[model samples]
Target: MFWATGWKPIVLAAAMLLASASSALAEEGVPTPGDLLAERLDERLGEQEVALQAFYAARDGRPAWQETATVAALANALRTLDADGLTPQDYRPDTLVAAHRQALAEQSSPAARARFDVQTSQTLLTALRHLQRGKVDPYRIDPGWEVPIEAPPLDLAAISQAVDARRFEQAFASARPSSASYERLRASLARYRHIARQGGWPMMPPRSQSLRPGELHDDVLLLRERLAILGELEVMAAGVSAGVEPQATEPRRYDERLVAAVERFQQRHLLEVDGIVGPRTRAALNVPVVTRIDQIRVNLERARWLLHGLPDSFVLVDIAGYRIRYFRPDGDVWRSRIVVGRPYRRTPSLRSSISHLTINPTWTVPPTILREDVLPRVRRNLGYLWQQDLMVLSPSGRRLDPRDVDWWRPGNVILRQRAGPRNALGRVVLRFPNDHLVYLHDTPAQALFAREQRAFSSGCIRVQGVLELAQHLFDDTGTEAEVSTLVAAGRTRNVHLERPVPVILHYWTVHPDEEGRLVFRPDVYQRDAALLEALDASPTR
Candidate 1:
């Protein structure tokens, strides 16, 4: 209990009246400030009462916000909650500020001061919690999403002492996400908001056919304006491609410079870099700025799920972008093109640690693939299994002849592909433990990676640089040499890593490019609507 349990700042007469009450509190046991808070919290947030009680009980009834006197320092930071794609209305800092002013003016008792402190601190804490972990539950949108359910560990004592030292703003600032990646996304979001205020990007006309160089049309002029607005083309008069003077501002020819600009836009949008405005490129051009804004918000929500406690070194597989980024202490050390699951058989978002690597791994046909992909082919052509070098295995591990089983009837037999060139698992596999049973592996169908949209796999990820990834994962030890030795032996081999590396398979459809410009990827699984719906609805359940 505080030394002056009932002492209150008041006029001389009220001060004298509190002297006897303060002495009486000392005679009896003073109710802890934590108890006073728990009493009120039990009425509003019953679930949080225990945690709040434990947090303040250790402080011996002293108020955490008593010395801070005002919350004026937190006004800007609180308002930034909206900039970070969160609703500032739900976590209003003004409420706490008003409470602090009222508590300071209270001339009733010392217990009154303590209760106000507890209530204010909890509101501040609630705001910080919502900032770090978004209000919407990932499981509600997609049950397969492996959300880290563990709440962020609270540093209540430190926060209390910091507030007591009049460092309330700095104390709560520490509670926001600490990931640089998330900060980058937030910065991009802010920049886009600025762009939105400026009337957003130029909208191009929907081209029914491909636009080629040397073509002069009104649509070409519109394309030039749009591209120039997006910073991919220089704003110049028409006929530059033909090296002729133009009387009007409208473009009269698709010059080489304009072709180069279109190519750059194509590259940025993850389309074929042919400098031609085909259907795909035209579609990318037509995506509205509002949709991109929603994409940024959706990805911001996804980022909150993993911003805390990231491994210093890890492999990030972006399923929607179909790419893998290996991050080290410095930054992204390596990257690779990848193929993820098809739209109907979407890959799950998961976080796990890479345990080991396998050389010449055999591919087991999963039940879903066996039923959907192989059975149709096997029924149409009996020699499908032989051509693919796959075999049927009985329950007792006996290799059954393909003719012995009827392809039309679903059976308990397993389809296993031998470790060879035709095997879908390819030459190497990076194994990780997760309930989804998915892993990163090399693919014999390397050509698939060159396509603009690479979601062709059943469920597992097919990496273009799996061998390079294996070499890097083994570089921590002399395992690189051992891996070479094992590959030379030409057999199925499992190589344990010197230390397991954390792997996160996530979906982020919007991220900034190297120039800090926001880049958007197609939502292959059509997931943005559901996430946007969740974000639009009240996050508080």
Candidate 2:
């Protein structure tokens, strides 16, 4: 009876529409189907209050279309839904006349209304962001989706298999390096593997008999052996975690060569490289198979997040691994092994835009350096400033008497000091506005970069290839030729940048190679443990 009652008015309205169309046909001015449909849809869904009340009432039965919570909520939903384009299923005066009455009835029923409005008002904002990003389709609704309370991206399938196997060998043998710096580990193994394949072990770098360092020979040999073990572990670990067939082709088992292999893994990871597997070494090895996978995923997400929207050129410093990479929009163009600050002077993580580059830049000893370094020296020796080639400057750039100003006075330490050849900043300063007071600059201590582990600076990054970087930044200004000329001239020259490229100093504990093999670097700042904990605790993968 109710359905029949609703159909009567709708059918009458359709008849009236047919008569009107016949008249329009006689007048030779008939509206197009698209135009007529647009008008009808707009009438049904375009008006804010009416559409909202209609949707609210449609959810349940209401006898009278009066102002009610259901109507208010439906109106809110209609207003919030992305309206770039939407269609209405019905639009006829007769149909609307009865449906409108039903909407009123629906609005009156409390049971018809939702307890809480689930439609977010930010749908328009999301669509706008997508449009700015050049998205095509605006709305994609999936009714079958269920919200996840918590999940991890780790390969649970492999982990389940690993657990099912009930063997640490499967877990350990299947592990692989998960950061960029570990590429050398793979390379080193390849070198040795090739040597072995040729039926000979590679010769170790010769240190003379006279230079026999005590307590170092066995450890060095052991470290080399450990390096080999790490390579084997990586191949095994990756294979197991990938749920691929085990590549356990090694004639020598890691357990059989445990003493030597564990040592090498420790040596490379910067843990105590003792042949014995202690708590620290075990902790390093015991990094859950899932944890490393999660770490790689997180780093990939971060790389995507940071590098996705960057300009055509930018310099990024990864602190946890103590390396800086120069990337063009095309991809990574240049990279270098960098020595970041020590634990005490840990390099900061930040976002910065490079303001300028000063070639042969003079080091202005910062107050922290002055207090921690110069002041202590001044206290030790009265002639410390002159000995170090430091010039005391007043606020006006005039040289102040080092003796006149009380070295120990808190006020005296506030003065800016001009640095000369022997200054802390060796020859250049890459300037950026950052509160960390850190920058990429030349260091007089060039030999430190040559060390295997380059975590040597205070809080700044020490570039191993500073001149190469300088050349890249000053491509337009003949800085490359100028720096070359100065070096040949055997004199230091200060050159200012014509245009500076922005440099970002960041920290990444893990990164991948071109082949997508993940490598792990030493947690130079000891950041991995905490990050690992956080990653494990995250509700989302």
Candidate number with greatest lDDT: 1
Candidate 1 residues lying further than 4 Å off, grouped into runs, are 1-47, 54-60, 64-76, 93-119, 147-154, 161-172, 234-252, 328-332, 477-481, 539-541
Residue 97 lDDT, candidate 2, scale 0-100: 30
Span of 10 residues, lowest total lDDT, candidate 1: 1-10
Best by TM-score: 1
TM-score of 2: 0.51
Using all chains and alpha carbons, the TM-scores for the candidates as numbered come to 0.83, 0.51
**lDDT score, candidate 2:** 0.48
Candidates' C-alpha lDDT: 0.75, 0.48
- lDDT (10s digit) by residue, model 2, range 428-513: 66677776778888777877766656777778877777777776767743434455555455444555566556666655666654
User: Positional deviation of 328 in candidate 2, in angstroms?
Assistant: 4.6
Mind giving the per-residue lDDT tens digits that candidate 1 earns over 301-380? 88777677777789989888788988864554788889999998888998888999889888788888888888999999
